[model samples]
Target: MAEWVERVDEQDEVLAVVDRAEAIRRRWLHRVATIVCRDRAGRILVHRRPDNMSRFAGQFNWMLGGATEAGESYEEAAARELSEELGVRGQPRFVLKFRCAGVVSPYWMGLHEVVVEDQVRPDPSEVAWHAWLTERELADLVRHEAFIPDAREAYDRYWATAANSKRP
Candidate 1:
């Protein structure tokens, strides 16, 4: 079954509903949710997109999430994605939302983070490989272009914020 997505304007106003494929093909601004899950050990969980994925195939990305469907809010989408893709449930802290000109399609992405002790069981179809990485290790992936491009943008902001918080 094909999935539907919410289309939005530059101001993030509801524009219309569209099939996910059509939206991607046209590079429309659609609602997407992304997560950065951290384990108690201070390591971040990262996963590789399946090789058969239409966009960013085989690229490593942070956490788990999917697009917000018609009439669903970003939080709802994030929570649902966590349950579906990671098999864990908890309130993820809202980080930020912004527009990204992604390689496949431009998107209005809502990013969140959660600290969890639950063992992550990433869905095989969505994630080909999963591992825990230190902040330095993750930063290396960004530098080497091993990470997904759009997600790299978000990670930059996330790391910047984290760095600031550590300032005395």
Candidate 2:
């Protein structure tokens, strides 16, 4: 049997627990969080989801992230996902929040980015392939439709903010 996480409604008043399969099948508007980890060399890590994934299978996305557990803060969930999926231990800084709307699953996604210097050992079950690319290269991939649309926006926003803050 698949596990189900308890989630609160958008209004933050009603609580409900739905199985993962039901959540996807019912097109529930749930909350999912992701983190973008970059290296000091200005390279960002990207991962390809397993082809068997139910949604967005074989698509390239950020290195590590997933849904936020009930009662879990966004930062806490991001940090936990980074360590759980990528095997990298570090604190992630919150960047922005975005939404991904699909025919079945509409999600409000929390975006976080972090800088790390350690090696990443991604979970084979969650990530099929991984790589690091410069911002320009990432943008090119986005242009070529090599990345998830939501991820592309997250990367662009993050890079834009970082660039603007570096100016004198």
Candidate 3:
């Protein structure tokens, strides 16, 4: 089955609906929704992708997400991804968005934040390994581990935005 996605312009205005592979192959802009999952104690949920996956295989990522379906809002996509990938559901709060100079392909990434207080049943195909880590530990892994490039960029941007918002 083909994964269809909306190919958009720099501002993320839809130009056409195309296959995800074609969009990636052409480096066409598309929208991806991602969620930063955290526990009540504020530990981030980090997962490693399965080696069998086509993109970013065996890479670590702090966000659980995928390309948004045609006409789907970022919030909807984030919610769907949370359920599909981690068997957990909660209202994902919109945090930030930016155009990523992607390692694989360029795309508009909408980053959301959600707290998972329930037990997570990760799908093995989507997540090969999972752990909740402190912010300092996650920063260490991001600096030293084989994390996904796009996600690393997003993580930096997310924290940058958070820091800016906390200023007087």
Which candidate wins on TM-score? 3
Candidates 1 and 2, the one with greater TM-score:
1
lDDT of 3 by residue, 20-105 (tens): 99999999999999999999999999999999999889999999999999989999999999999999988899998899989889
Q: Which ten residues in a row have the lowest lDDT in candidate 1?
A: 159-168
Per-residue lDDT of model 1, residues 92-140, tens digit only: 8887888988878899989988887898788898989988999888888
Candidate 2 per-residue C-alpha lDDT over 70-117 given as tens digits, one digit per residue, 9 for 90 to 100: 667778989999999989998898876655664457666778888979
Q: Name the runs in model 1 displaced over 4 angstroms.
A: 164-168
Worst lDDT 10-window in candidate 2 = 5-14
lDDT of each: 0.85, 0.75, 0.93
Clash pairs of candidate 2? none
Tell how far residue 166 is off in model 2, in angstroms.
6.2
The clash number for model 2 is 0
Identify the superior model by TM-score, candidate 1 or candidate 3: 3
Q: Give the TM-score of candidate 3.
A: 0.97
Stronger candidate by TM-score (2 vs 3): 3
Error of 3 at 113 (Å): 0.5
Residue 12 error, candidate 1, Å: 0.9
